[model samples]
Target: MKKLTKFKRIVTRIIVLTLVLSCAGGVMPSTFTPNAAELYSDKEKYISYNEETEMYEYSFYDAYVYDIDATPGQIMLDIIPSTGSNYYNYYYHKKILITWHSYNGENAAQYDYENQKLAESIQPESRINIKFAAKNKYDDLSYKDGYLGWESHKDFYVSQIISIRNSDEHIYGDINDDGIIDSFDVVTYQKYITDNLQYKLDETQFLNADIDLDTEITNEDCRQVIDFTLGSSKGFNGATNIGSIRIDNTVSQAMSLGVKNDIDFATAEIKFGVDVLKKCYDPEKNNTENILISPLSISSALAMTANGADGDTYEEMEKTLGNGLTLEQINEYMAYFISHLPDKDKEKVYLADSVWFKNDPTLKIYYEFLEKNRKFYNAEIYKSQFDETIIKDVNNWVNKNTKGKIPRLIDSFNIRSNTAMMLLNTLYFESEWQEPYIDTIDGTFTDLNGQKHLIKEMHSEEYQYFDLGNADAFKKPYLNGDYSFVGILPHEDVTFNEYVANLDGKELADGLREYADPETIRLCVMIPKFKYNYQKSLKDILTKIGMEKAFDPDNADFSNINDLSVEGALPLYIDDVLHKTKIEVTEKGTKASAATAVIMGMGAAPPEEKKTIVINLDRPFIYMIVDKNNVPLFIGAATQLSEN
Candidate 1:
């Protein structure tokens, strides 16, 4: 119960200011919309070249669709991507479902290609189609509806990239008008499940009975739907109403957002370190640093994996805990370690919505961390295939943990002969600065050249500024409430690479809060509007950054693992680390999206920068994500138009 520090207050104020500004940006994220006319109109062109046979080995439309739940003989991909002349490629055409998830949940999908029935309970294990769900962000398959194919045979070397339609803009199923998801108008949903009955309803009119989310049509379901339409309780059940996205209202106002995740630290390190901190600095309070600790969510993924049976899942894991142990006690044991070292300066995007299902974003580490602390005998490190089945469990775990708010983060994992493994990480934060900037009257921003960028300044009169003279990096800290918007704007004359190579200054980070000016200037700033994408495997970057020690098979030491015979069973290699970032600041406020996907065999995308002495956020520029210490976390360059 610590009082909010000045830094915490500032961050919170800034977040609220930025959200307000984001609302003012007049831009809304795009959603899914489908067109029947377009689906029937054009056929994608075919491109093919043969390298081995020295002639065209194969050619076809690279397009694909995803009707992930559709059953065999059901209305799978209606107009599957047309195959080329070889005729042999037809096998690749049909609604080929990727074989993934060993689904055992309540709504577990079943495919009876033999009886050609879908609504029936999945036999002990029946044959199925290819898996359509993407387990990790690194999965590159451009999959959709039922048809998934490669643009060129060379791309076949990589996983497919699922082409999910933006929102209602999905590739299929736009049959209803209620703005709610109805299955009737969908293409891949070919059947409806009822009590021991399966009905073939392919049109929008049949969607009235889809209540249980089993893609079904029942008289009882229709009655309930109609009752709600007429505002009557006869058919209305409010359970569905509760299953919506909820963002966290409390964005961290504190300097570090007080996020305490219990990771691989042994108990020897958890002994209260407050006494250790008191000796370092002199302050009014007994301790100089204020700390926050957040409890880790239940590890649903590993719970299911302990004995591998639902009836035995929780029971099996609990057996490891003493008979007297309650779920509550297990959680308390997991709260031991806090990030002792200061949190890196990360301007991370916070998800404000409350997690509903509360199980969707379950990280393996989240569960592993809990198990390590649980003191249960069953809580030992175990080897897993990291396959699609495991990936689905991971998704469900995350979905349940987030409480149904995070969407599109865990699509589905595919299990193919060539498919290897996946690692997924999801983070959420929301906080404002402690100090609110003064809402000024027509606050104008001026660039170094004295050019007025016509910036829609956040009308804040009260702001902290830096008087660092000619360096032009720190002039005015964009104050949104207590939070400060500082930029590592690169020199206009230098290429992004040169700027990064030359940027090794240690004291530059604190310059924003400490050495900056405290004046009200009519700052005329012009920031850009853009989203950038880059694709480069990370083996090169990590090696160059001297973190190669983490992945060296000969030297890698993951001895913390509780159950391994050897210290390092799994090779710690990063197949890819993609950094993606986007930034925009205006009078309305700021909205940015950035991420450094640490993919073992997978990933994408974030760090943003502002580079305009002229301050016109236009054209190309490179940016790096840094901790408050300004240590380069990830580097990125945004060129509106990509050449490489």
Candidate 2:
């Protein structure tokens, strides 16, 4: 019995030594055999020892444990070296190299400068165990803990057993590591998935290409990369929390104030729209012409210009634009309205603002004015030579913002020598109908002048109908029910001019506020397909609406825009207010673009239906595009249907 005990003890010692050597990363002897008790009993199991490779294979872990033949000095250098070509310095301080050595179950000690020297002195043939941990300084690096070796370390002798991989964290879709997520990354990712690149991605690039992080690169991953390149609000990982607009805490706090006062601003805007429409429309002279205007566009441009007005000039603009609301309230509300506007695939509304001033030493624009516009309206400010080139630049900007609808906003004739600065605003809208027209028929549209012309009329059944005593109205919704197109046809006895002339802002606002239940009201609606362009100079209209002093060259005070205290300084005043608009109404949807320029010299829906009503717009009528809040975006009088 004593002899048997000694033999078992010897076998146990051998097994323990083998385990220690394997764990320490030392080569296992081929002649050695593991005890039956220590070896896996089921040889068919996925996890088992391979005698040929002298390693343990774990199919479930998807990893392998192998012995590495290297000295303590070489292993240490592989992890973190004292000098040249060290893994620690290769990351260029972007990553913190953490390393330690363990033997006989000793606790880990930081592999600092002193330990590095001690490790370097060890002989090459001596076996040593080393492990590495790396922390990213920027917290942007992606890390995986395993035995997978980086391509850069493939040639190293320690790579077979090393667990350290040094890869810089890359922008999610920037596969090429060029520090930009763009179209090139999309192309490279496509080539990689199709094996068309004639090369394979490195470890880092391969990880980045997996934008969805699904461990498999498919067409979906490629599509996500494309979406990110195309300015999607979502990130590469398809996280929807990302926002296109960065609203700082200050802006966020102000947004609450704006929301509280939205109704007051809406009332003022409606009043302003009605007043501008009445002044611009001449029933006798423009009886045969259609008139369209974007109240939102004009108000935005004037609001931006209002920032540069001081004294009485500012008061008049504040009263006219805001109906008594202070500039602070106006700025905050405008910001709130813009940021809350819906922008999606089917429905898109974009508003862009820009300010340009003559580049002359004599004229000095206040930084505060420019900053205020930037903070509130996000207006782009520029200093130009006021030459022909500026005209092209301004026109190109307008064209781009308007989606090429209004190709030119200014000409050489508009930019005079005395023009100190110009404030411009552009609004673009494109949306599909909630219920598209199914059929079209030939019809005749009679102008107010009694002239008749053939027109194509889109026919659809609408559920929401309104009776305003003086006119019959219908509201057709756009996609998502966020906005609608409203039409009002006056009674046959009431002339179109008389109906408009008597329209009051409060009455119009109150009339629109009345919502029709789809279950109770229904209508067979017919609207003519029309496309036209309209332009007007608002110098006279604004003067008639209580801004006469703004146009006076001597009385105008735009001291906020420029320093009037300097000697021989050209006093700034409102030079001209130009408004241009274009609209196209088709069976599918509506496309409208408007631009308003305050050229300053120095200073600046619903559902259900039971009842039905037939409403045909074969004569002159009034139309408007309004939001869910009943706030008007555009209002027009379609007196004629001729294409412009």
- The lDDT values for all models are 0.28, 0.66
Task: Give the runs in model 1 whose Cα sits over 4 Å from its true position.
Answer: 1-385, 395-425, 429-462, 465-471, 474-482, 491-497, 505-507, 510-515, 520-522, 529-537, 562-614, 621-637, 641-644
lDDT of 2 by residue, 295-329 (tens): 88999998888898878888888888887778788
Task: List TM-score per model, in order.
Answer: 0.35, 0.59
Candidate 2: the clashing residue pairs are 141-169, 420-601, 518-608
Off by over 4 Å in 2: 1-261, 602-611, 642-644
RMSD of each: 26.8, 24.4
Worst 10 residues of 1 by lDDT: 266-275
Alpha-carbon shift of residue 618 in model 2 (angstroms): 1.3
